[model samples]
Target: MDESRPTPATPPAVLADHAERMEKLLDRLLSPQTLCDEIARPERLRAAMAHGLLGGGKRLRPFLVEQSAALFHANTDAVLRVGAALECVHCYSLIHDDLPAMDDDDLRRGRPTVHRAFDEATAILAGDALLTLAFDIVSSDETDLPPTRKLALVAGLSRAAGIGGMVGGQMRDLEAEKTDRPLAIRDIEMLQSMKTGALLRYACEAGAIAAGASGDERARLRRFGEIVGLSFQLADDLLDLTSDTATTGKATGKDAAANKATLPSLHGIDWTTARLRDLVVEATDLLDPFGSKADILVQTARYIAFRDR
Candidate 1:
């Protein structure tokens, strides 16, 4: 530990601290209120961009990156920027997910969807800008990682958010809506793993890359990320099924209405609940090697399983 740098925080404190820090970092990254009149930028586009990104959410993906990086004693400054970049990807996804052609959402984070708040064209552009900016953020010298590590992070995020991951998952979801038969378990798993799990796995993998962890160590963290990703989707499915729009800050019951395939949709509530608990155990077991240093990451898995949104 360096003399000037603070000591590692306790688990609860670290989670809270990371949340606050990430929010600030995101605010700086996504704040549209500061754009100048002297530029060639569209004011509405910037506003829509801000509207989508600045809306309150737990920012869970970035937290995974931050906490996972800490487990390896990686540079905090680098992790903060990397976390912010990951957030850009997440916010972009939400914007696109709410578009009329996609989920047809009217609300997000208890407010109007980006397309509703501005217009569909602006919303689409905002998502595009955010998606591209994520790469820009990660590529900058400010992230402070070596070139190899930065390249790895960039490549991983692209794959996670592009055709191989979230985007591909979204396409699958849309196709499923037209089907008469429900998706099989394997299909649902593959879909959710691509749509949601890919980014999460990237978050943990980004941490390992930033820290220059050994391949085997990164492998363990990647497993933890995968479990967390599945747990996240399960909890999200449960929330959509049980929590009202007011509680979740987004439209609830949309999955059923849209006929989207999910584990809870197929297995029912009890099975989903039990499965989430088992995932928590499995995720915790993966962290046995890190012991006390993993306390916050462990709590993060719990939070994902039990979060209100």
Candidate 2:
């Protein structure tokens, strides 16, 4: 080990601190007072939006954005704004995913889902509002990035969240449920990459884009993001099979209940566990060139793969 390299240990407290800061940032961003002119802000709509957007999670996507940007020495405030925008998109997906017409979930992050807490129509509108708000946040003056960088961020996020990405993947998932035939491993991988991996890949790439990193550096983080994304979904499937709603703060075993063909369901727990470990190794190795500056991300990869919830 080089004497100048920073220690590799990244305590859980570091992640906790990041989460705490993200929570405050999200709260401020979602607040009605920060949204629009008093006359334009609707109370009920804002309330519904708050119910979903303010709901708690680990804020891992935003953390990825911020941390990845730090690698290239991007502006902190601009990076955080981009992170917040990404989070809005994530929250929107969760809200819509929980609706009756979709996964029909009733709980999320330990409370009533937006539809159950409010109404289905309101929930739908809230999700739409959040999705649009994300673009606004990125394009608006508050983000403080150059026009070119903002444009790049906007385009990247659109592709990640749009029909060819998360939306398309979701459609594939739903279509798969309707058919009796099980998905091939390659098909499953592609669907998972689109549905869950796109945003994550973009999160790291966004950092590089924000900092004007070379194409090689951007590609490196993009690969890292892809590895982390796979590990994230695999771990989630494992938790769904092994953990309960009390532990996960949401419905458990839904994949099995829905007869969804997750990798764990097909390949079994032992295989999934080993795969996750391998993915973490691959992700960390991709960051080795960054030295100790990548330690937090290495820790993040482990946390994503092995987190209990």
Candidate 3:
């Protein structure tokens, strides 16, 4: 769902600000004119893409990309564009995930899912267009990065979004549902790391690529990304157990309904929440070398762990 403005209680100043900026930028990016406006652009397809992309969500993946690049003082434009590309992939995944063949949900971001708003075929086509558009945007000359960096971003994104990463994990998730065996903790971790963690991990690495960060620096960021993916998975599983559909802005309790194995189902909410807290500390500590420069990321980690939705 769209990020709720931070209150005195949450105090995620950096996240609140970043989320606002990403939303405004994305509004323009998904507009018809930006998406190759043409008399033949097919208004209905464009509309479906817009509905999927412009709808409410945290935009956290983009924020992570941009913030990570900020650590290396990378170009602002390049950072934002990289973040935008990642968001396209993320939004496209959601469009497909909510389809009848996937999660089979009627609601997403507090409104009808793309399939419900339009039709299944339109939703599928829109998702394909958006996913392809992401690569196009990342590789555009307008991104102003070197050929080497652009290639790195392209190759990395392909792997993250493709069979070795997100797709592989999704297939595993489907298999988990079909089998009679209960998923072990390791199984859930492996499943979640791929299904949810791949894009998140790529977001950080993309930032490093944007800045031409040193191998040591990139490695550190990559590890940080891994931690983030796991942390986000735990928090999400917790939300599934505790939050209502309205609060989450999407269907809740679907995991149990679908018999999908989630970490929270194996470990109760109290334990999962506690693990999330520990992860917050570990994530921040990983940034100690950067000190105050990493404060925003530290707070972002805390927000991810504690968000109500």
| Candidate 1: C-alpha lDDT | 0.83
Question: What tens-digit string does per-residue lDDT give for candidate 1 at 1-309?
Answer: 543222222235566667788878777765544333436667677778788887477677888898888889985888888988888899899999999888888977678999998889999999998888889889986678889989988988888888989899989888877789889999999998998899999899888888889999899989999999998898889888888988767779978887777788788877887788789799899998999999888888877786766
Ranking by TM-score: 2, 3, 1
Candidate 2 C-alpha lDDT tens digits along 1-309? 443221233335576777788888878987768988888888888888889888577788888988898888775888888988999999999999999999898888668999999999999999999999999999999888889999999999999999999989889888887899889988999999999999999988888888888889989988999898998898889889888888767779988887778898889878887787789789988999999988888988888888877
Candidates' TM-scores?
0.88, 0.92, 0.91
| Top-lDDT structure, candidate number | 2
lDDT of each: 0.83, 0.86, 0.84
| lDDT of each residue in 126-202, candidate 3, tens digit only | 99998999999899988899899989999999999998888889888878877987788898888888989999989
Q: Of the candidates numbered 1 and 2, which has the greater lDDT value?
A: 2
Off by over 4 Å in 2: 1-11, 243-251
Candidate 1 wrongly placed segments (more than 4 Å): 1-13, 31-40, 242-253
Q: Which window of ten consecutive residues has the lowest lDDT sum in model 1?
A: 2-11
Pairs clashing within candidate 2: none
